[model samples]
Target: MTTGPRGFRRALNRGIPRRNRTLVALVAFTVVLTAAILVWPTVAPLTGLVVPLLLGSILLSPRQLPWFVVFLMVMLMLAIGRQQTIEVRTVIAIAILYLLCFIVLVTSFRRTRLGVAGVLGESMLVDLRDRIQQQGGIPPLPPVWLVETALRSAGGTPFAGDFVVATRPRHSNRLEIALVDVSGKGEQAGTRALLLSGAFGGLLGALPPEDFLPAANDYLLRQAWAEGFATAVHLSLDIGTGEFEVRTAGHPPAAQLTAGAGRWTVHEA
Candidate 1:
């Protein structure tokens, strides 16, 4: 029988799909912003609104972005048309805005695939990287044992072809470690690294020490990616006995430093 302003707002919000709401709001704000810029075209800095709108568009659906761009293009054209004589700075500003729009639009398309928003896509990549790092971490070991791991990408970037996954399985005194180098370097191999990191991490302590590589090989074969291959080293070490088995797959041999002899011994792969 009665509805408050808040209730009306809630009802209105419920009508629009959750994904498109940001796009719609940004487009509406653009219209108002365009109006203000037009009203005081000479007084106001026209390019002031460009960055915010473009940044906001990253969170919007790619399909929704083209439409938003269309609205933006129309607003920009109308603003220029309304002016009796456009300044050189105005034309330069407009050109810069167009270039930014093109860059942002291209980025949105490349980053957001299969209907995923750019923000979500980026967050997912971050989450995957975090998981890889977490999996790479060596859990707290007893004081007697020391296990070390280090990873460096081909370049100075978060994404890389190299990663490691180590785990101490329940009901076992053995530590399982898998060192993987996916094909390519940096972003080119980052996707494959993310994928194999999880899979190799899962397979690390799951199977018997000797079965790990064959299983990993099987998993890689299933994907059937052309020129897609990875090099990995699996090491399962028994803390009690100080005995270990290092399995290699298209990877370099393991090296060990003999403390007493003060020499490095290379274990054949």
Candidate 2:
């Protein structure tokens, strides 16, 4: 088994996720700086640096913030006790610290619009993913054929770069479906996927078959994202005649399952 400092460090590393490392580092820095000022009161003006550090509270959860705030209060009180003659600069620094802390705390409290979580918290993202699922729901297919679809991102997350939007427009026998793969690999892209899914679902049936892809391309272009490129396949099918047209933009060919041969074949766009 593992022993001592190296092993302890390894265990600690495993305890926190990569995203939270910055918070842990800042907390350590605050403690070390506080100790330094306690030993050398001449450096008390440096406490203002802590105010800027707390600005990181924007990314911190409510409960996680108290650690920094409480410790900061203790550090300030200690500095006040140690410094006999507080300089003008030191007084200004303390005032700025108090103002900044108050602002950040207020901002954190106001973020309670989600009741418990932030407005763009994980819960909100999950809700968006559910909406995307609902938007991608295939309309009631005719009895003769079975249709199945699968969408999962890398590592099997609820968030994915790939999404589908489908609809059978009112008074129309045609079913229009679009499978879009957006660029990027994380939550930001997943959120974008949900938003695009909504936009594409509306455009799919509302625009003529020939106009849909161009309209979608135009819509995406207007957004002007840096990594904005997306691949999409648009499929339009006639319920009665079984005739269909498949179009693609930077996406793979549509696949057809040959039931008799039990194999998948690619349909050229």
Candidate 3:
């Protein structure tokens, strides 16, 4: 009913995606072994070495896979070229060579280090999401999280006007966050989003709701050039204060949810 780390690792190994190159090499080795066994009965046992080499490659990197293939080819050539007479010295020499080449090839593939950068990037992304949750923000659910989750993107990447921040501390207060989608979608528009996010992040942290809009706009004007303009919404909610405020400019209005009613309205500042 319970599993330890080893069991969990085994499960993970079983669950590993079979579509990766490792699985590809394994399948290729199996097919090649079966063919060799059927075609050359006398050398059928030697075909077993192919599987181990392929397995090593799976535990290695794409860059080292070619060397593994080369090692196997060399061994196969040596075995095939020799006469039927079995000599102890020849067998020992071939084994030593194979072992040396395998060691060198494993060292070269470096599965342990090859994908490290990608692994680190993924870990950092998770850490960012956890930090956002700690800062009273909610992350977007899956599928969206995989591609273009505003919440995830906002947390992981630098401040961008991609998502809103909201939090409700049960013992204290409640907050409603609204995100503004800019008029365009590109690097230029994205730069403006960054500017807006910086301005909003600063103003929302300290300024009152009334001062937030003007302060954000002033900051944006100072940062963005003549060709750069942004439309945004600033939303604040105070359940204890029994008040809500939204200031916006040509953007989607926030939806207010109540026990029995739903309403849509826009607030322009």
Kindly report which residue pairs in candidate 2 clash with one another. Answer: none
Q: Model 3's lDDT to the true fold?
A: 0.54
Pick by TM-score: which candidate is best?
Answer: 1
List, residue by residue over 22-132, the lDDT tens digit for candidate 2: 568777777677777778777545665564355556556665555566666666677677776877987887788777777766766666444443434766777887889
lDDT of 2: 0.78
lDDT winner among the candidates?
1
Candidate 3 clashes between residue pairs 3 or more apart in a chain or in different chains: none
Tell me the tens digit of each residue's lDDT in model 1 across 74-122: 7888777766667788788889888877776776676456667777777
For TM-score, candidate 1 versus 3, the one ahead is: 1
Candidate 2 vs candidate 3, TM-score winner: 2
Best-first order by lDDT = 1, 2, 3
lDDT of 3 by residue, 1-269 (tens): 54999898777668775435564565466557645744663666553655556465545455545555575655566444543544687577557656755674655556445443233445655665454334435433223222121443433444333545443433445454546554444443555664455456555646666776677668767865767666666666665565777777656555554535665444445
What order do candidates take by TM-score, descending? 1, 2, 3
Q: Tell me the TM-score of model 1.
A: 0.86
**Regions more than 4 Å wrong, model 2:** 1-116
The C-alpha TM-scores of every prediction are: 0.86, 0.59, 0.39
Model 2 root mean square deviation, Cα atoms: 13.0
